[model samples]
Target: MRLLVAFTCLLAGCLAQKPQPCASPALLTGTFTVVTQNEKLEIYCKYEYDALGQRMRLQQQGTYQTKPFIQDFLLLFREGAMYQIFDTNRTCIKSALKDKFHPMEIPKDATLLGQAVLGSSSAPGQGLLVNTWTGDMSDKTGKYLSVVTEFGCIPVSTSYQTNDYGWEVIHFFNNVVGILDPSQLNPPDFCKDTVMKTDEEPLNFLSLFHNLP
Candidate 1:
C-alpha cells in the first residue's frame, strides 16, 4: 500500500541512527494544516520506523488547496521541491538548494533592495517562499549569519493534541555576506509584531537549539 511505504520511510528517518533500534515501536502519524487570513492548506501523513524506530524518509502529497490550484507534489527521499506551472501544465520549476528555505524569520532588517517578495502565493504549487534578494544588497550584517535550512516535513513539537507537521524555520537570509538588517528582520507580515526573536541569556554556543544539518 502507498501509505505503508510512506510510513516506512518516516520511521527509518527517526530510528535508523539510534543505538537500540526498535525500542520505540510505534510510528508517528498526523495531519498538518496552515491557515493564513487569506489562505488555507493541509497535508495528511503516515510514517514507518526502522528497527530502532528511526525516521528515514517522508512522503507528502497535497490533500487540500485553496485560493491557488496546486497539482500534486512529492517529497523525494532526500532531495528538493518541485511544482508545475499554473500557466503551463507541462512546465515544472525546480528550486536550487537555497530557495528550499522558507517560512523563516529574517532576524534583522535595515536595507534598501530594488525588489519585492510577496508571500509564496505569488507563485503557485510552491510552499511559502520568501525572497529578500534585491541583488542591490546593502552594506549591513547581523548574527545568526543568515542561515539556510532545508527540512522536508518534520514536527518539532506539539500542542492542543494537534500534530504540527511540515517544515519549520527560525531564521533565514539569502546571499548575505555577514550582516543582518533591522527592517529585513522585522516580524513577518502575518505575525504583525507578536513574534520576537530569541534574545535569551546564556546562548547555546553548541547549537543545541539551532536547526542545522
Candidate 2:
C-alpha cells in the first residue's frame, strides 16, 4: 500500500509541472489589432515576419491621438534600417532601426498562470487548449500577460502595460506558417526617394509614430 501511494504521488507531481516554453514558426504572416487604454490609439495591421532573415514588414492603418494615418514599414534588421512609407503622401523616411528581432514565444523564465479551453470542449477537438503566462518585459520596465495555443505556440493575444505606454492590448489572428511572397519584405520602389534620417533618433515600432507629423 505504501508503494502504491508513492507511485501515485510521483505521477501527480509530474502532471502539475508547467510545459516548456515554445516559439511560433520562424516565418509567418498574420493580422493583428491593437487598442490602447482610453481609446486614444487603435491600429489594424497585416504583417509578414521573417525571423530567419531578420526582416519584417507591416502595412498598418490607424488612428493615433485621434489622427488617422496609413503607413507601411519595412524593417531590415541586418541592414539596421527601417523604411517608413507614408502611403497617402507617397513619401518615405529611412531611419535607423535600433531594435532586434524578437520572436513570438513564451520566455523561458515566464511564469505559467494556468490553462483553459478557448471554446466548448464537450466534444473531441472542439476547443483549442491555451496557456497563459506572465512575465516582465525585457527591459524590466513593464509587465505583460500572454495567451498562446498549447500545441502550436501560436500567439492569440497579449496585454502589455508600461510606465510610458500605459496599457495596450494586441490581438493576433489569421496567422499562417510561412511568408507567401519574399518580395513583401523589400522596400517599395517609391522608397527609392526616401529621405535618410539616420542622424535623428533611432526608432522602433512603438516609437515610429511619435515622430510623425
Per-candidate TM equals: 0.21, 0.85
Candidate 1 lDDT over 33-84, as tens digits, reads 3222222333332222221212112223332333332332222212322221
Number of colliding residue pairs in model 1: 35
User: Model 1, which residues run further than 4 Å from truth?
Assistant: 1-29, 38-68, 80-93, 99-213
Tell me which residue pairs clash in candidate 2: none
Q: What is the lDDT of residue 176 in candidate 2?
A: 92
**Stretch of 10 with least lDDT, candidate 1:** 204-213
Deviation (Å) of 156 in candidate 1: 11
List model 2 lDDT by residue over 123-193, tens digit each.
Answer: 99789889999999888878999999988898899998855458889999999989988888988788977
Which stretches in model 2 have alpha-carbon errors above 4 Å?
Answer: 1-17, 86-91, 192-195, 209-213
